[model samples]
Target: MESKKKEKKALGLAELVAIALGGMVGGGIFTILGVSVSIIGFMTPVAILIGGVFALLAAYSYVKLGVYYKDEGATYSFYKRTYPKIPFLSSMIGWFVIFGYISTIALYAFTFSSYMISGSDLAESIWARKLIAIGVIAVFALINAWSVNGMGKTEDFLVYTKLLILAAIAFIFFQNGTMPVSEFFGKLQVDWEQSHVMSILIVSSLTFVAYEGFQLVINGVNEMSQPEKKIPGAIYIAVFLVILIYVVISFAAMLAIPSEEIIAKKEFSLAAGAGKIIGIWGTRLVIVGAVLATSSAISGTLFGSSRQMAVIAGDGFFPRILARRKNGIPRIGIITMAVTASTLILVGGLELILEFGSVTFLVVSLLMAIANFQIRKQTNSSTILTLLAILCLATGTVLIFYYEYTHQWEQLLFIVFIYVILTVFSWFFSIREKRRLHREEFPK
Candidate 1:
């Protein structure tokens, strides 16, 4: 009885919000800062704001579906339950979404390692970075495998601490910035000559992945109390906070660092900016904040996505072994995710991993919006908002592919190949499950 009570108290509104923030704050802002600045210059904050709007659109559907269904399976389960006739759709989402989470794990781990070695003598050693990335994933996997309560408490500390650190970094940048706020805004007008509307939209589309983890709040529905209320509450609050954080940080970086430097040191732009303005201590501060941010992201992703993976496996859409759980946690799923993400870190470069993740979640969120649109009445969702969500996400999806097609056709091809492979696997599993059900119903 006492154990049950303790378990119930493991995650509350604060912890739920922390998980969502942890997931969203990870490698997202850090990864996209230089890229956004490069593409839009002083208008990078505007692009981030637009990106946040799209995220809010995507969140609307997710929140509505989460409230209606309240399932821990989240994206996969919501779609499956909404459209029972097309089990393949659900299976495909499960596979694609899990891989999306894998891409993020790779993104966060890679970002963590990059910042970890930024000031060190081994900063340029690719092998050392990869090794550290793998090591961090392994460490977090063990932490997650140990206990849910422990993961939540650790996430709470990391997420909130990083928030404070990020705020401080922003404050320092604003205080000691090379560029004035008035000049920053003026550049938006004068710099318009250098950037086009299409470029800004493309940057905004890519920023979608930075907001990817808010849905993780839903994945913890079963662990939390009054999930219907908490899911939407935590997710909305987290997204709002993340948007503010990203926009402020982007604005600060632009003010403190030159666009050329930002583009050059794309991976560690914040740290580089801090070093220039506030010295080595400032750089070290940003790095520490980034490490904590990415660490919590890894921990939260492993916790939420592993459970979603286990739920999908239990539905027989994935290998049954993935469904195995210990101490109410999906041990096998957590380790498998860690290993796959590490392999991705080794094989894929930073930009490739970031783009793949952005595309995956954009596609997945678009699908969720479509699903929500179909059952708008049931979920008490506005038809106009749902339809608009679909349109916005669809446009974002097309913009990403367009950006990649023009810039990196090879990466786009790789993303397509991955989708084709996941589709095939989803089809095979769906058919097998269907056949088994058929046989059981009409017994030979």
Candidate 2:
């Protein structure tokens, strides 16, 4: 009976780390690779490494808070609990985080669709891609609604299998190099001087989105054993692994593919590069890897973010219906997230979705860092490290907006508009909750 009970609890450290990696390694890498290469040329790996450093800084506070609170509510819960007096701030974080996940869901689904149709006649058809994006979200939302154990096992399989495939792809790039390794290094040195320092930092800031999903591990605090240990361990290990995978893959893509072509097919650069270098089979393999990567991302995001949404709704910060769950799974929240993400995919372009997700998460992570810093003594966190985390995240947030302002001012305005709308809704809910509390305190 003891053995059977242990077997039923399938998400050990390995599985939890897999969830984090599955979430972190999705469409962000595929989408950002070409853009990074275009901006920094062969020095793209350097930018990726810098991005990893920023991710580590951001993770420090998250791990501290995760260990301190041990709430499955993760981001929103931590903030709300830390400063109970500011209910509106917590509501804003909840809305921002959920919508952030929604945007990334759209991002992963769009990337999946891009690679799904990479070799087909409908590859250039925007409507066809959008339709497939919606279909994939619906499929994964159902999978999440079905069972937690099933989602864990599926995530483990997809995460590890995609890692293997990505490793194999990297190996192929090195073994069947179109250009000599020396030539690639030479290009890097030449590009190094031509590339502005700000450009590399900007690219690094953009890559933060690739590291967004590692926090999903905290959402599994309810199911996992010894979360205080597992949450921090899983998150740190997962972030390191994702950095390795991304750096290796980015280097390989640059070595195998020309910069011009990479920039040309920015949406599906990996597939395009593999097709050019290794022919049709390589392209097909990359497509398979991308499909698995995005599928697991969609699954993990829906699973984790929906639970947070349900928790927020229970607190009266969102719709009460979202609080309903079956067997500990938030089915309605999952479905609602899927629908909203699908709507985003239909209406928004890939760049808009990606940038919105990136900015939203950066802002949310910055808040987490501040929350952890406020309770650093209680959480037993290094105050210096926590403050550094705050500094780095704050800088990254500013850099992202600066990048947008310089390059795409229109999109910057659109993002600002969205934040305003979310803040207004959050304020409305917070006020209502306060009034209700006041009534309960002294009933008329």
Candidate 3:
């Protein structure tokens, strides 16, 4: 009877989907819209869709490893278990994955602040945005630290409400757009001619960061019901839904807003463009959607990543205090993540944070593909599909690097520098863990 009650209380498909969607749909569309539109023009949806395809490929390995191991540590856990001989490798993944999530957290919080204050005079003040971003992060951290069930329910509401609002936004824009369907196709043709294939591919790869939240599904395995079914089911469904949402929303924006205006407004493009096309109420609605999108994202990311952080800490890769839990919630890990993300928002520029996150997740996902490929038979993953995933993910990582090299070399250097710092931390912890093991074995 107790077991049945526990099973009943575990997260079901709906809550799992909400967690994944909450992670993916945050400030991603809002943050990428202006940047993608600037690069690919009317072909932004194509690039976004291509990004989703890549995201699906990345999820393949995650799903297999997730079901096979059923560990909430996720990427870090998978690699560690797959290659137990090399402690440093797992440590590297653990550090990179956690910081990758932190970068996304910072990205979402910053976007939240950007859209939150877009209408007010404070929008122009960087400090004001940073403070607000930090404030929102703190709020969600507390919510997550409160209880897992409360966080899940809140995420469900925020994610579904934002989706409905986004759908309505798309429909309204499509209905009000002056561009004919034929003209829309014509614009795409022109965009194809003017934009290089490499440029569109780069944008597509860059958009993968927006899809990084899918693995958060696997992170909830411990608290979830039926891992074998729900892990893959919820992840794939959420990814598909996100792709549809991003494509429809991007399509609407392309039809109703001018490319130049989108690029100029950047983070504020949706609300401002909607207001210009429709009215103040339209602007307010879009703002509400964006705020909801980011808020849920903050909550979901904190919920999943903090758990992973606690796992890594318990494994001796991070401060062990983070492993401490109050009523099964990793309060210290949640607080640490919130503080680090807040710091990143205070110091990092929006473009830098976005690009950094994209690159980090691409690297992490590629590593996951490699790990799954090695253990394909054990995980029951298709060898061919895993190989294809490796190839596609590798191509994405290279393309992003090439784009950064050609366009933003400074950002590339900064990303490299941050990795160096993380590598040092990982190596230190890996060595410490090794020594601890050695002491345990020898009893000197």
Q: Candidate 3, after superposition: displacement of residue 238 in Å?
A: 0.2
lDDT per residue (tens digit) for residues 189-301 in model 3: 99999999989989999888888799998888888777999999999999999999999899888788888888998877888878987799899999999999999999999
| TM-score of every candidate | 0.97, 0.96, 0.97
Cα lDDT of candidate 1 equals 0.90
Query: In candidate 1, which residue ranges exceed 4 Å CA deviation?
Result: none
Question: What lDDT would each prediction earn against the true structure?
Answer: 0.90, 0.88, 0.90
Candidate 3: regions farther than 4 A off: 1-9
**Superposition error at 295 for model 2 (Å):** 0.4
